[model samples]
Each structure stands twice: as C-alpha cells, then as structure tokens.
Target: MTVKNGRRWSTANAYLRPAMKRPNLTVVTHALVHKVLLEGKTAAGIRYERKGNVQEVRAKREVILCAGSVGSPHLLQLSGIGSKAVLEEAGIDLQHELPGVGENLQDHLEFYFQFKCKQPITLNGKLNWFSKGLIGARWLLDRKGLGATNHFESCGFIRSKAGVEWPDLQYHFLPAAMRYDGRSAFDGHGFQVHIGHNKPKSRGWIRAKSASPSDNPEIQFNYLEHEADREGFRDCVRLTREIINQPAFDPFRGDEIQPGNGVVTDAEIDAFVRSAVESAYHPSCSCRMGSDDLAVVDPETRVRGIARLRVVDSSIFPTIPNGNLNSPTIMVAEKAADIIRGKGALSPSDAVVGMDENWLERQRSGSPERVAM
Candidate 1:
C-alpha cells in the first residue's frame, strides 16, 4: 500500500457535512467550553464562550464529556473536578475531587529506524508539487493511485526479547522515511520502521495550569522512565536492523540513516532513543475507568461524585491499546451510544485472543543479546 491519501479521514472539516445535516446534533464552532454547569453536586449542563458571549446549554438527561484524554482532564479540572490541591491552587471551588482525573497518562511512543533507499522506488520523488497534483487529480477522478493509502502495508507484532509473556512490541513499516510531523528528514529516497514497545511501564500525567478553560493544560508523557522500557527500545532498534538487513531488503536498503553504525552500544541506543523518540500521538488513560481509588470513572463511564455526568472517550481507557486511538475510540463511542439509548448491551463476542505461552523464550531463541543480558 502507498500513502497517496491524506491523513485522518474523519478529522477533516468536510467530514462533518453529514453530521451537520443531523437535525438533533447541533455542531458549534468557535466555541470554547468554559465549564460544566453543576447544581450543587449534579451536572446540569454546560457553559461555553462563543464570539465573546457566554452561552449555556441545558442537558435534559445527561452530560457526556467527550473531550478526549488531554481535553477531558483539562475540562474536568476547569470544572473543579480534579485533585483537591490543584483546584485549590487554581482558586476554583472544588466540586468533586477525583485525584486520578489526570493521572496515568499513557501513549504509544515510537522511534523511526530509517534506512536510505538505494533506488528511487520510494515516495520521495512524488512529494513535489507537480507529482502531488497529478496524484491528487488521479485520486479525485477515481479513488486510485498513490493517493489512496498511507503506504503502510506491512507490520509486525512481536515480543521484544525472551521471557516476555506476549507480543509487547509493535512495528509499522513505511516505504518512505520522514519525521513524524511529515517533514522530510533526509533529501533522498528511504524507508522507515516505526517501531515501539506495545506496553510501556512509564506513566505520565496532565494538569490544568489554571481555572481558565481556554488555557492549554500541562501534559507530560514521562517516556522511558522504567528500565524495562529502555531495554525494550534497545531490542526494537536491534530487531529492526535485523529485519532491514535481510536479503529481501538488500535490493532497496542503502544505509542506516537513523541510529547509524555508531549507535551500537546499549548506552548509545538509549541516548538515541531519549533524544529521538516521539509519541505516536495516541494519548489515553488520563481519566481511567474503574472503581479503584485512582480511577476517574466507573465501569459505566460515570463520574463518581457527579450525577447525570458521563465521560465517553479514550480518557476513560484503563490502559492505552496496542494500536492507534481512533478505532478504540470508535468502539468506546459505540458502547456509550448504546448506554445512552438505554439499550441492553449485546452478548459478549467471546473472541478468543491467544498468545504463545513461551513468547519470551521464542523471542530470544535466535537472538543472543537477550541471552547475555
């Protein structure tokens, strides 16, 4: 597959055309949520700012917070529903104190193992304006050509090393190399393995700077805070090198442009990871689901102390999923919709998820590095 298509099909403004035609669902623009209006301890409605005017929307049945991980916690804190100390510092009268509101922030962080391509088969040549326009025209005329897919065809779900119980590493192979933000890092044809540990022991948190709703909240993804996480990165680098160096890629593989030849030592790899690693833009679990003390929402997605309030987003994910947040968020939204409609949930799918019992041993079978460790 090639990434001839633009990113995030549902995010573009044009995707809202169908939603805009919905009579019951009113889409508001240029509005910032100021607060969740609460009568005593019950969530009544919401207040927002639009065109310098404060507007209120009353909820007839429930108030669902779908602001996502970062925005959900930020809005919760803005509505005086977070840690007691944080609300006190922000001078907002605490409505409901959920200490875990912004805790347990998790994300899928990745590092690119980029290799320069020996040939011009990659997307580097088609990135210019002329090629882009022709590709776009071809796509607009018929949903085909290089503009159809993300060009991310192959992927691997493997264990990082021996002794792991399951597949803890995820790899996404791209036929072109570039920065995560789409900037070309090298002016040549190349490929990249977007690889990272599926499960990270490191945790982070989000906090509101003040009670102001428009102010951006503080976000910290304390990545690679655990020794195991660092070790996982080391394994990711090594395993990617092993794959790219195989005979299959010998025709296209040129040189390792990312951690290069000098980054062999464990310390060197760790340093490189620390400097180059980036979030896969998949943040979740800031407001986790559970009945535990650290949980911000119950299994039903309701805020503990606030009546008629629910959180329906990835923010309530107990842990980040192994993949991107889009699909999981869709699942969450679907479930929440059923709940909102008062429909009985369908029977469990009972889809069996199996993994090798000796995943770790299997991972390290031919890899001598983990044996020495």
Candidate 2:
C-alpha cells in the first residue's frame, strides 16, 4: 500500500481522517478522557465524559496517551500518577509519587525580530486581494499554494559561534511581515527571523491548574534562567544578525524593527529577549522516562508504578529533542505502537548516544547536527 503523508499537518488530517471509515477503529472526538480506570495497578480502561454524562471504556490490552505534553501530564495526574500531594488533594488515591510526571518541561522559546524590507520581497507585500485569489485557486485545484507554506521557508542551522561543533541554535526565516502580536498588527511589507534555542537548559513545568479538562493547564516555561542558556541566547541573536546581513538576504533588508538597530549590547539583548520571547508551542518532557525515582515512566514508556498504561506522546521524552518536536513526537508514537503490539522496537540512539553538553558544544562550533534520539 502506498500512503502519501504531507509534511506539516497533524495526524488527524492524514491518518485518522481516512482510517475513520474502517470498522476496526472507532473515532471519538467530543469525548474527554477523565481518568484511566485501573484494575490492580493495571490500566484496564478509561473513564470519559460526553455531553453531561460520564462513561467508561475498556482497553483490552493498552491505553496509549496520544495527548500532547500538557494533556498527557494532566491525564497522568488525574490517573494518580503524578505528584503525591497534588493527587491526594484532588481525591485521587496515590498510585505513584512520580515527581517527574509534571517536571522536566522544555519548550522552544521563540524571539521574533521584525524588519521592513527595502523592496517587496517579503510575503507581506504580496498578500493583496488578487494574490489571495490566485493562491486560493491554486489550492483548490491542487493541494499546493501559499496555503502550503508552513512558514520558515529558509532556515539557518548552525552553532552560535565558530568554535562550537554541535548545532545548538536555529533560525527560522519568514518571508512575510508578521507580528509578535496577533494577526491584527500585521503590516504588509515586513520580514522577520525567528531565533530559537535548539537545546534550552532553562526547564519549567506543567501543572494541572484546575481539575476541569476544558481549563488550560498552567505552563511555567522558566526560560533563560541558566547562565549557559543566556549566553547561548546572546550568541543566537548575534548569529541571526550576521545571517540577515549576508548577501542572500540583502534584497530583503529592512530597518531593524524590534529592539531596533540601536539595541546592540548583550545586556540589552538579554532584557529584550526575556520580555519579547514567547513559546514555540513545542512543550514536552513532562512525563519523562528513565530509571530514576522521579521519572514518571520507564524506558519502555510504561508508567513506573502502573501497568498496561503507556504514554506515547512527547511527554515521554527523557530529554526534549533538539529541534521542532512534532517529528520526534510522531517517532515516539510509532515506536510505542510496536511495544504495545508485542513487537520489539528500535533503540536507535541508545547504542551511540552522546550527552547534551557535547551536542551543545557542537552547536556552538557551527555544525548543528541532528542526532538520533
């Protein structure tokens, strides 16, 4: 069988959409999984809610949590696999004291530097009514056009400086005029380079702010706390400036719009970055897997103190990957499906895994390599 998977869309669009027609798989969208029903420490089923009523559904073999980082941790906490104090207060029996269940949270912190292009090479200048109509026509006829732009058309993959060897920094070049603010402030003739950390040392956390599933979980991304992270961030900013000044982007050159051209000092950059940077929306590692006491799950993605429940999402990453996390998250799910089906999974990184520091050093030197994880 041949399957064509698009690059950027979520699994719901690619896999579940067509698979829903199959009788073996049932698609439940509106249902909210409230908790994992346990039978003698084994996850036998799930308690879910629909409309105003609650119900339970059994999993004959396993309950894989495909919930994203935040959702998965909340599910674990609700299922009594999180902090002991939090679980007890929520009236959940303490099944585990896995402090790491909602810890080790890492996210790509993004800083956008806006600029005005000299010419109209930026996407902002091209988004007129006619352009929109043409692009829409192309998309309707074939699944291609401006609609297919996932941004970051041109990217810079490098270390912060020449001495470093691993790729610790990444730059996403956007051809359009975008804003850190919402779509309203969008000017039609601007360009931006979104600078981000490949391996942010400043870790934060995910916590169930409220018991209600509708309520968003509190995400504390304590970014730029570590000295190394701050230094790395400064290097990333300098690198971004250097890349923008290169001949490849000369035609798109505009006045420095953010922190402006005058903000050159490291101290100024640090202050500006802290105030301006926001989430890359790549939250992960809240339910880290390891052999340590704090680890919420084991190497196999199974809950440390429970059985038959596996977290197959980004949460199980012991250490968050060094790039945009969606691809890595899908790989985790793929490997997990094998484990759940009694098929042996591949441990690609275990045989020749290097430490984070080595990778960071490599990034600092200029060659930001994609290491297997």
Candidate 3:
C-alpha cells in the first residue's frame, strides 16, 4: 500500500510516484466521482466526470471510497444512499435509505492565545527575510531545521478527573501564532499551546446545502454545549497559562497578546473561547459503526443494506480517536484491504500500531508517553 502520511498525503507521492512502473494499478487524476452505479442491488461501477464529460469506471470485484469525511458523505448522498427526504429534495432517485449518512459530525475545537515574545525563541520573530533565509539554508543542508517542525510540537491525552475511563482531553503545543486564512485556519507566531476536548460528548451534522455536487455542504457543530466540557476547557486554558508562567519558560515570556492579561474569570474565558475557537479540521462520526440499522456501516465497514461497496475512511470511526486521525485512517485502510482480499481482518496490533495492548495499558495507567503543556 501507498505510504506517505494519509489521505492528505497525495496518492501520487505515496503510491503512484513509487509504483508508476507497476502494471496492475491504473492511476487517474482530475476525475470526480458523481455516483455509484448499481447492478440490481450491488455496486457495479462508478460514474465520474472529467474535462466536463461524464464516464464510468467499472470495478470487476468491488468499489471502495477512500475520500475524506466531507467528500465521502457527499458522494454517498449523491449516489442516492442518504436520507430519503434530502434525496427527493435534491431531485435524485433513492437507492438506499441510510438516514444517518451525514449526521453525528464532530471535530476538535482549538483556541489559541498569541503573545509577543520578549526573546527570539518564537517563529513569529523570524518571519523577517534574514532569519527565514538562514533557516532555509539549514534545512537545505541538513533536512532538519525549522522545516522539520509539524506545527503541533507536543501532545498529551488526559481524563478530566480520576474516575473517567478514557482520556477526554488532548493538548498540542505550538511555537508560533495561528491565523485563519479563509479556506482553512492555520497556526503560526509566538509559542502557543492548544488544548481541546478530544472526545467531545457533543455532536453536530453535515448536510447538503443544494443538489449540485459542486455545492459545499453546511457544517454546524454545537461545540462546548456540555457544562462539564465547559469546565474542562476552562481548566485546560488555565493550566496552559500556568505552564507559560513556569520558571522553565521565563526566558521566553512576553506580554499576553490574546484574551490578554486582563481575562481571568471563567466567563471571560468562555467568551474568548466561543469567539476564537476554530476547527482542528478532524471531522468524523458522520457514518458511524454499530449493529443497529440506524448505523451507517456494519463493523466490517460495509454500508448497511448495500452490496459490493464499502467505506474505508474516517467516516466509519464510531468514535473519533484520541489524537490526530491520520494514523487511524491509515489503519482502517490497511485492515480494509486485507478484509477485501479474502485474508480476513488482521490481528489488532498487526495492522495498526496504536491498538497494541501495551499502548492501551499505558493510557489506562495515566502514564501517557508524553504530556503537552
């Protein structure tokens, strides 16, 4: 299988770039899937458009959707496998009635506070041409400078209190400020720490705003709706402030730049969080896994009541993972491949790294490999 990162890692770089010489895999680009073509009740192929022309790509054995959360649900709805009401409203014929096709959307909410560092230990201080050139030179020579940073510098998972069974909170440390540049938000600037409730009890939804596949769906997340969640986030922020105030960080301290030095009370912090928080862009649970008919996919990831079709992506995560979804998404694909090839599901840890018993034991003991500030 292709290996780079995950879906965000281009298939060209991960799979095609290395395997162009292989004769078995056919690679196509700029092809947009419009719908799944069914032969009676089983998927026979897919309808796609390219260069303004619609065509079909038939699979001899099966069809799988590797599209991310948004694209995956959109494809399902477009293929007449969504709620009957939505399909009729969009003037599309219904093939399947999976009412939960686009429900249960959840994502990590991130809020950040920027500070003007008194010293030059931050990325914001180096945006100038001179420092940037030096940094580029170092990366060019050694492949290990500022370029090696992956935005989130450190990570940790914690349960809110002692009795909780699973870690509910996640933290990410950053060495720069963050910005929202329209298409998506980004983090940059002075050292900052991001704290989020990893397993939010709250849920949201994604729905088709219109019939056209070109139309982007609406994303409505009711974040921070639970009282316990509010308290947890408040604690996370306060803990971050405490970390910044620690003596180990004194040399890089700077004036508070966001929610500033004046914000201390829970109410003020709540207001700041509501206005400033944005998506960590890790949406999931729209098509959850379960035994109930309301569930979108069965435990094997086969769409309920659908034949010869499967969804192999984040959409099937009954609950979102404790950290970045890239790892889990890859694991799902790997296991799915084995299942499809008649080899059956691989042993838990054999296919996925994080599912190891040792890892779970570490998490259970509250002895995570690392803890973010």
Candidate 4:
C-alpha cells in the first residue's frame, strides 16, 4: 500500500532496494534449477546446476517455483509435470498430465503512434551528449532529474467499444517519440503513445526445446490471430488518432509518422498492425490457475497431482489483469506468500468504483454523479 504522489514504481526501485540489506535473506546467483526432486507424488527438494556441477537442496516445507511465465512451465515440464505430449517429445518421462501447463500464454501487443511536434519541446533534444551530461550531473548532485522517471508523463485506460465491461486498452503517453525499448524514432521533436489492448483474446504456448534447462523454450504468441484482437488494435489506432487530433495538440501535432495518413480503412489498418505491433512483453499464464481439467495449478497455487509443489507467479494468473504485469505480479506474490505461510486469506476489500452506463457519450464531460448519493 505504498504511494508516492501519482507515479508507480518497479521492484528494484521499491521492494528489492531495502530487501537486499536484510540479514535474514540469503540470495543465490547463477544457479539453474535442473528439476524438482520428487518423492512419489510429493516434491521433496530441488536439483540445480552451478559451476557446471549439479547440486541438491532439500526443502523443509514446499518447493516454490517463481521462475515466471515461461521458466515456471519449463521447469514443471522438465520435472515431469506438464502435458504428456510435450514432456514425451522433450525426452522427459511424464509424471503428470496438465494440458494447460504451457498453454493460454498471453501478452499485450503495442505500437507507438508517432506524431511530429511543431515545438522543439521533446526528448529528442536530450539525446545529445551535452544534454545527457547535464541530466546526469543534475541527478548526481541531487536525486531530482529527468532520469528519475521513465518519462511516460501521462497514461489512460479505455474500453475498445461499447458493451465492454471495463477498460481493455491501455495508453502510455511519452513526451518524446521513441520505441518502448528506447530506440529513437526521429531526430526532431515528436511524441508517441505506447498503446494496446490489455486483455487480448489471442493465445499461444511455450514448449521446452529439449530436456536441457539452459535451452530456450519454443514460444509462439499467435498475436493478432483472432478477429477480436485485430479489431481491438484497429480501435487503438482510431481512438489514438482521435485523441491526438483534439484541439490541444493542434499547436504541437505535426505529421503522423507510423501507419501514416495513407493507413486508413480496415484492411490497411490491419496490415499496419501486423507490421508494427510489438510485444508489450507482459507474458503470463503459461500455467493457468483453475480447477478445470486443463488447469495446471489450482486456486491455491499448488500444481495439480503434485504435493508440496506450488507456482507463484504470472504463470498462475487466472486472467491477465487489464494493465501491466508489474503491479498484478507483485500482488500475486504477496498473496502467494500468505498462502505459503498457511495463513487464512485476507478478507476482500469492499471498495468499488461505479462505472457509468452512458460513459461513452459523456466521456469528455465528467458531469453527473457517478454513483448514487
């Protein structure tokens, strides 16, 4: 429940900075988990590799796997707790059959809508060595500088269309035109929005290339495969155009750089999305949580058909939240920590935000009481 002004923080800047100083915690580095040591149907310990040699460590309680969406499932598969077909193909003996282990993989697809700016007030000016030195010097002198923030000055979440339950599309507005990876788009002044759908219906999977833990998994996101996903992206482009087209940007807005003026009509937009859309890189749910037949982990985060083994990461997210993975992932880890400690789940929060039924019509005007008096 930490809050600082209006900005959100990352693990390294928030949690781990103080955590690394704690005397009770032991940090292990460069160790690769070979497999979970299983005694019958129960997870007994861990077999890992370090310095080109295998090592074993017995777990006193349960073996928690927090290797994230891809790594978690890969470990489960290597330890013989995944789809029989995948495990068999990977040269591993099958011990459990969970067809959903590496399935239901989800990630947001994003593209920057770059618009040239008439004014020179953008990050492009700061790219030079002189400006970079000034920014660095300011930060060195005091903790305040341009480097303090990611520079995503503003953001928004909105529904793709009517009848959508909640906001599915997310927008991260950057004052400078650049890729999410920090790749420069132009030398002149410009701005962009890192916008995309959060709850994409498109699905894919992760498969271990072989039995070796070091090998990269075969990943196929199948992005924009479904009609809804494609349509959602189309809405993203249209809606963004509408936002930047507003009177406020008339002074700053210049030419459209991506999907340019020619990229109109459904077909052209579709093609542009296919060409320009990039992974928001929020991979999750390769080991989905549920009690159904395909569920890899149950609601309690325990791997089905295995005792003393649990996965506590984005891999077990029942549904990808309508946002980035950072906050939701941290919340997941916190709740999982409680569950691991055998504590009763905390009572649910009662706070709720009431949504307006006619929000689309009055979106610009925040008039009328949102909830009952």
Candidate 5:
C-alpha cells in the first residue's frame, strides 16, 4: 500500500525518480519495442517503433528486459527466442528454443461477496455527486478525507480448511457494494468482502499470434480448470458467509446481496463463482526462473543459454505468491540489481513466526463461537 501524503507511491516515484537525473539514465515513452536485436545467442540492443518511425538502440554492455509478465514473454517470442513450434507458426526464424517462454501463466481470481447493510454507515452513502465533490474537495485542500484512501481498510488471510500449511484464501473488505468500475450494484446501503482462492492449481499460457509486436498475444488463464480450484471457491463462499454472519455484523447485516441465501447447494455456489469471479490482475510466472529444462531464466536472472540478456520483473517469478505482485516484483528487480553488481546474498532472517501448534488438526487454534442462523 506504499501510500503517503495522500498519494500512492509507485516504482517510478521510488526508484526511477532519483535515477532520472543521472547521466546514464534515459527514459523513453510512447514507443513500441518491436524486438530485441540479438547477436547470435546474446542480446545486443532493441528495435522499436516511435510515431510510425522504426528505430534501433544498441546496448553498450547488456540488455535488461523488464517489460512485465505479458509484455516480457511476448517480446521474447517476437525476438525469436521462444518455442520452435510457436516461432515457426508465427513465421519467425527461431533464434533460441525456450519452450517455457510464455507458458505457466498464473493469476488470482476473486469475487465480491456482498451483503445489504441495514445501517447507512457504509461508503454507499457517499456515492452521490455532492458527497463525492465534498470528499474530493477535502482531499485536494488538505490531503485528508474518504478520497485519500482506496477504501479497502480491512483484509484477512486464512486457510480454506485444515491440513493446509498456510493461508490459501485472502479477503479484502470494502464498505460498499459496487463493481470495480465504480458502478453501484445495490440500490441501497451495502458492503462486500473481495474473497479469492489465492493458491490456485490451474495454470494457463500466453502465445504470440504473429511475428508483429502490434498484434496482441493470445492470453488464456484457464481459471478453475482444476477440481481443487472449484472446491476452493465453494469453501470461499461458505467461509465468507460464516465470517460475515457473526454476531459482530448482526446489528448492521440485512441480507446477502450476492450468491444470495437461495444459493445453498455446492452446484449453485460453483455456478455463482463461475459467473461472478474477476481477475485480480496479478499475472506472473510466464518466463519462470529455474534450472529445469523448461526454465526460461536461470538462478541469476540471466536468460537461459543467452549471455548479456536478463529479465527483471514478475515474468521471472518461479511461482506467483499468495499476495499482490507489486512488492514481489520490486523485490525481483532489487535482487537482480544486486546480482548484476556481483553482490553476495543477504543474510536470511532468523525471526520466529507464531503459528497454532494444532494447525495440522484444525483450521484455527480454537473454535469460534457460533450461533445457528
């Protein structure tokens, strides 16, 4: 959440800002990179298109690719550095044979488990034009008020069931029932908890449609393709219902707004999840890092079998984490930077983490007090 002074902080502000003044740094925008100019197995530079004009920039030493999950794999494929079959079908001569370049795509999918609120304390009350104007004015004037925050003040992470080593489900509680695009879902006051099966077993892939970079890649995240993921969603619905129906919410809770009380059976829950779930947009693990045959990059972030070329983004993640990709992606770049500088690895933390001793037997250390609905 790296937020301060009422503004969200991003990598550009944190890392790139200071480096902008350095003589060695050059920032280019509004340019479409066509491909990496390769010298046999080594990356020598890049070819790009700017304002309909083609251009090439030669690298003095090496080429570091940080084009992100989708862009990175797509760019690699365009540069003739992907699967032999894929490159041949796309009418590009193969420069390298990395079968895992665009494979192993992963992402998080979540749905808003919404409920009508009997009380008018939620952010639904602030959706009117006048209220929004006031909120905006306050923030612009003093950098304080409802407009200063993303409205996701509460969140939780818990395992879907017992026998799980760690939390596989994540929650983001929002005080309003609305779509991500700000469209209201309810006519009155309501709230929701964005719940998701974080560690999905389902995997998909991204492939280049053609040799042209202008053509978007064929992306598919065969979500819920696995039975375990479907079961996980069922658990998500039931567990979220149990948590939200506690005595704590009894005073303000009115009725379930999504996956309504009528959706009781497993089939019904599955159907609801299938239609309601949305991407969390945390796509990663395309050009995964490893020492295996399918690995695209090696332990040091260097592209496999290719020198002077490296990928420094979430594209190199061995596997997607249970949380957001922002921090993890930053960590990847930071670690790659240290590796490039020939720095030794940092000492691992020896801090102790608290966990329920009976975690293997039960989801919680103690049973939560429950009342029959």
Candidate 6:
C-alpha cells in the first residue's frame, strides 16, 4: 500500500519530480522506443518513434533497460536478443541468443469471496453517484474521508495447510461487495475477502508475435496448471469459509453471495475457481538473473553475453517473492543505482522476524485472549 497524502506515491513523484530540473536529465513523453541500436554485441543506443517520426539516441556510457516484465522482453525480442527459434519464427535477425528472455513468466491469481451483509454498515450503500461525488469532494478539500483510503484496511496471511514453511495464502478484506470493474452483483449491502495463493508452481511465457514494435506480445500464464495450485485454491475456499463463520461475524454475516451455498464439492470448487479467478497483475521473472544457461542476466544485472547493457526491473528477479513486487522492485532499482556507482554493498540488517512457536505442530496459532473494551 504505497500511498501518501491520500494519493498513490509512485516512483515518478518520489524520484523523478525533484530531478526534473537537472541539466543532465531529459524526459520524453508519448514516444515509443522501437529497438535498442546495437554494435555487434554491445548496446550503442536506441531507436524510437515519436509522432510518426523515427529517431535515434546514442548512449554516452551504457544503456539500462527498465521496460518492465512485458515491455522488457518484448523490446529485447524486437531488438533481436532472445530465443533463437523465437526470433527466427518472428522473422527477425538474431543478435544474441538468450533462451530465457521471455521464459518463466509468473503471476498471482485471486478471486473475491463475497457475502451478503445483514446490517447496513457497508460501502455498498454509498454506491450512488451523489454519495461518490460527496466522498470525492471531501477528499479533494482535506484528504480526510472514505475516499482517502483504498478501503482495504484489513489484511492477513496464513498457511493453507501443514508442511508449508511460511504463509502461502494472502487476504485483503474489503467492506464492499463489487467486481474489480466496479459492478455490484446484488442490490444489497455486502462485503468480500480477496484471497489468493502467494506461491504457485505454475509457469508460463511471453513471446513476440511479430517483428513490429507496435504489435502486442503474446502472454500466457497457464495458471492452475499444477495440481498443487488447484489444491491450494480448494484450501482457499474452505479456509475463507471457516474465517467468515466465526462468532464475531454472526451479527452481520448473511447468506453467501459468491460461489453460493451449494458449491461445496471438490469438483464444484475447481469449476468455480477456474471461472472466477482473475490476475493480480504481478507479472515477473521473465528475464531471470543467474549463472545458468537459461539465465538472461548475470549476477550484476547485466545481459549475460551483451556489453554495456543491463536490466533493472522485476523481470530480473530470479524468483518471485511471496508478496507484491512493488517494494522489491524499488529495492532492486536502488541497489542497481548503488552498484552502477561502484559503491560497496550495504551491511545486512539483523532484524529478527516474529514467528509462531507452535508452527511445526499446527497450521496457525490459536486466537489471542480478547479483552473487552
């Protein structure tokens, strides 16, 4: 939840805003980079198209590629730096052979478990245009209202079953029952819990469809292709039901609105999951960093066989983390900046993380003794 002053705190606002006045910095808008101009195996500069005019910009020292998970691979393939077979199939001359350029694509998939609310204390009541306008007005005036927050104030992480080393499932609680596109399923008050398996064994790829820069790349996540992922979603449905049925929710909980009360069998759960699951938009690990034959980037984030070029984004992650990639991607950029400046590695922190003492015996610890207010 990277937010500040009631607005999303993005990298552009934090890092690029103050540096816009620097003499050495230049920012281009509405331009599409067509490809990286190469001299043999070294990156010399880039070719771009802006308003139908093609242009080239030469690099003084080196070129750093930060086009992100989808763009990075697509741009690399367009520049003839990817799997030999893939480039040949796309009718592009091969400049370098990196078989892992667009391989090992991964993402998190989730679904909202919605429930009808017996009480009127839910955001669904404020779905009208008048209520939304008022909320927006309040936030614009002082940044102190329902619109100030994303409405996902509560979250939790827990293991799906035994033998798991850490929490594999993540939860985000919302007080409104609506689709991701803002469409309400019913006309009554409701709530939902966004639950998903954080770690999945499924893998997929992204490939260039053609040599044209304007052509969209082909992406296939192949989610739930593994038996463990299917089992994990079944655990998600059952475990979410257990949490929602607690005594604390008895006063407000009504009938189940999603997947319904009749969807109880294993086959039914699988069918529901297959139809209901949506992408969490955490695509990563396409250009993995390592020393293996399939590795596209090396330990220093540089392209394995290419000189004066590097990748600095989530695509360089050797493996996806258990949580969102936002913070980790920021950390990667900061570390890459330091490395590029020839700075020494920062000392590792000795912070101790808390864990359940009985974690080996149970999936989760018992509820703490609640004290009345």
- Regions more than 4 Å wrong, model 6: 357-361, 367-373
lDDT for each of the candidates?
Answer: 0.85, 0.75, 0.74, 0.85, 0.90, 0.91
Among residues 3 or more apart in sequence or in different chains, the pairs in candidate 6 whose N, CA or C atoms overlap within 3 Å are: none
**Judged by TM-score relative to the true structure, which candidate is superior, 2 or 4?**
4
Q: Ten residues in a row with the worst lDDT in model 6?
A: 364-373
Alpha carbon lDDT at 325, candidate 5:
86
Tell me which of candidates 1 and 5 scores higher on TM-score.
5
lDDT of 4 by residue, 197-256 (tens): 888888999998788888888999998888999899999989889878877789999999
Pairs in clash, predicted candidate 5: none
lDDT of 1 at 195: 91
Model 6 per-residue lDDT tens digits across residues 197-304? 989999999999899999999999889999999999999999999889878999999999997899999999999999999998899999999999999998889998
lDDT of 3: 0.74
After best superposition, candidate 2 residue 235: deviation in angstroms? 1.3
Q: Which should have the higher lDDT, number 3 or number 6? A: 6
Per-candidate TM-scores read 0.91, 0.86, 0.83, 0.92, 0.97, 0.96
RMSD of 2: 4.8
lDDT per residue for candidate 1 within 219-319, as digits (tens), equals 89888998989999999988878877777788999988998989999999999999999888899999999988888988888998899999999999998
TM-score of 3: 0.83
Candidate 2 global lDDT: 0.75
RMSD of each: 3.4, 4.8, 5.1, 3.5, 1.9, 2.3
Model 5 lDDT, full chain set: 0.90
Model 4: lowest-lDDT 10 consecutive positions: 364-373
Which residues of candidate 3, in runs, are more than 4 Å off? 1-12, 116-118, 178-189, 344-373
